[model samples]
Target: MKNKEPWYATTADGVPLVAAVPLVDAQEEEEEIPVLVVPPVTTSEVVAFAAAAETTDHPQPSAPTLEESFQQQLSLKEVPTSTTRREQKREFKREWRTMKRQAKQEWRQMKRDAKLEARALKREFRSEKRALGRNLSDVKQDLKQEKQMMKDDAKQIKWDAKSKIQEKKRELHHMKRCMRKNMLAGTFCCH
Candidate 1:
C-alpha cells in the first residue's frame, strides 16, 4: 500500500472545504486509498468559478424540511381509492349545498332590507310633501287675511271723506240762504 491516510480539501484560511468521511479507516484498513491533492484556491477564485458555472435557466433545488417531507410521503402513500373518492365527492357536494343555501339566505335578507329601506324613504318623502303643502296653505291664508284688512281700511277712509264733503256742502247752502235773507231785510237784525 502506498498511502493509508484520510484525505480532505481546505482553503487558505484553514477552513475545511469537503467534510465527507473516508470509506475505510486508515489504522485498520490495509488497502491503499488515493488522496486527491487539491490545489489551494482563494475565495475570489472560488466565487468566480461558482459564478461561471451558474446558469439562469436551471436553479438548484433546496432540501425539503421534515414537515414538507412528511406531507409528501403522506400524499404519495394515501392514494384515493374509488370508495374514498366517492366519499370525498359526496362531502364536497354537501358543503357546496350548504354554501349555496347560506348565499341564498343572505341574498334574500339583503333584498328584504333594501325593500324596507325604500319603503321608509317613500314614507318620509310623502310626509315631507304633506308638510310642505300645509305650510303653503297657511301662507296663503295669512296673505288673504292681510289683503282683506287692507280693503276694509280703504273703505273706512273713503266713507270718512264722503261724510266731510257732505257737511261742507250743507254749510255752503246755509250761508247762501242767510246772505239772501239779510239782503232782503236790509237791516242789522240779521246779526
Candidate 2:
C-alpha cells in the first residue's frame, strides 16, 4: 500500500491530472468507538452563560442601604429654594427703579455744577474788563494833562520873546532922538 497526498495535482492549463491509484480495502471491525452526543443549548441557557462570564470578569458594587438614602434626602431638604419667578421679577423692578432715580439725581447735580461754574467765569471776565477800561481812561487823562502843560509852556515862551523885541525897538528910537538934538546944537560931526 502507498501513502497518498491530500491535494490533487493540476496541469499548466488548470485541468486536474488523473493518475492510476490503488483502491482502499475494508476489514471487519472488532471493538466499537464511543461517540460524544452533545445537545443544543437554548436561548435562556446562552444568556445565563454570558451573564456569569461577565460577572466573573468584573465584579459590581453593592447598592446603598435604605438608611443612607434617607440621610441623603434629609440633607438635600435642608437647602432652601426661595428663587421663584415672581420674586425674581419683583427684585428686578426694584433695582430698575433705584437705578433710574440715581441717574436723574446725578444728571441734575451735573447741570447745577455747570451753571455755577459758568456764573463764576462770567463774573471774573466782567471784573477783568472793567479793570482794563479804567486803566485806559487813566492813560487818556494823563495824556490830556501833558498836552495842556505843553501848550502853556509854549505860550509863555512866545510872550517873553515879544517883550524883549519891543524893548530893543524903544531903545533904538531914544538913541536916534539924542543924535538929532546934538546935531542941532553943532556939537556932533556931520560925517
Candidate 3:
C-alpha cells in the first residue's frame, strides 16, 4: 500500500485496494461521507447462481384473513383524479423532504451532543486510554523479551547450564509479574 493511500471505503473495486482516510480540517475534524458499493459480476457468480437455482424451492402458503381478502379486493378502487392527485403527490413529497431534513438535523445534533459527552467523560478520567495502552504494550514488551531470552546458542548452553536456568527462571518470574500487573491495570482501567 502507498504511504498516502486513503483509509476508508471509496471506489469499491475490490475494497478500494485499501480503505480511505477521513479528510481533516486545521482543527482536526473528520469529514463525513455517504458511500454505495456495487461489485462487478463474473463466471463464479454465474456458477453460484446455477447452484442456487438447482437447490432452491419457492413454497406457497395457504389462506388469508377476512380483512386481508377484503383489502385485496377493495384496493383497486376507481383511479385517482389526475390534477388533484398530482397536487397531493407534490405536497406529500414536500412534506416528506421537510421531515427528512428535520430528522437528519436532529440526528446530527444528537451525535454532536454524544461526542461532547464522551469528551467530557474522557477529560474527567484523564490517562485512561493511555494507561490501557501502556498495559498492553508492557505485555507485548515482556513477551518479546522472554522470546529473546529463550533464543539460546548451543555452545553457551553447554558452558553455562546453571546460569541459563537461573536466567530463565528470572525471566519467567518477570513475565508472571508483568502479567499480573497488566491484569490489575486492565481491571482498574475498565472499571
On lDDT, the candidate that comes out on top is 1
Cα RMSDs, all models: 22.0, 21.7, 52.6
Best by TM-score: 1
Residue-by-residue lDDT tens digits, candidate 1, 14-123: 77776545556566757665454455668999898888877446766999999999999999999676568779899899999999999999999999999999999999
TM-score of each: 0.48, 0.47, 0.24
lDDT of 3 by residue, 1-191 (tens): 22333335446465443333334432343344333334456799799999999889868797999998889778776565547877989989999999999999999999999999999998867778888889999999999987777765555676598788889999888878777877978743211
Q: Give the TM-score of candidate 1.
A: 0.48
* Residue-level error in angstroms, candidate 3, position 140: 26
Candidate 2, position 63, lDDT = 96
Output the lDDT of residue 157, model 3: 78
Q: What residue pairs are clashing in model 3? A: 6-19, 6-20, 7-19, 7-20, 7-21, 8-19, 8-20
Using lDDT, rank the candidates from best to worst: 1, 2, 3
Candidate 2: residue pairs that collide = none
Comparing 1 and 2 on TM-score, the stronger one: 1
Superposed on all Cα atoms, model 1 deviates from the true structure by an RMSD in Å of: 22.0
Off by over 4 Å in 2: 1-86, 175-191
- Cα lDDT of model 2 by residue, 1-191, tens digit: 23434234568997555433323321232333233333445799799999998778666788989999999999888966559999889989999999999999999999999999999999999999999999999999999999999999899889889888889888777777778878788676342
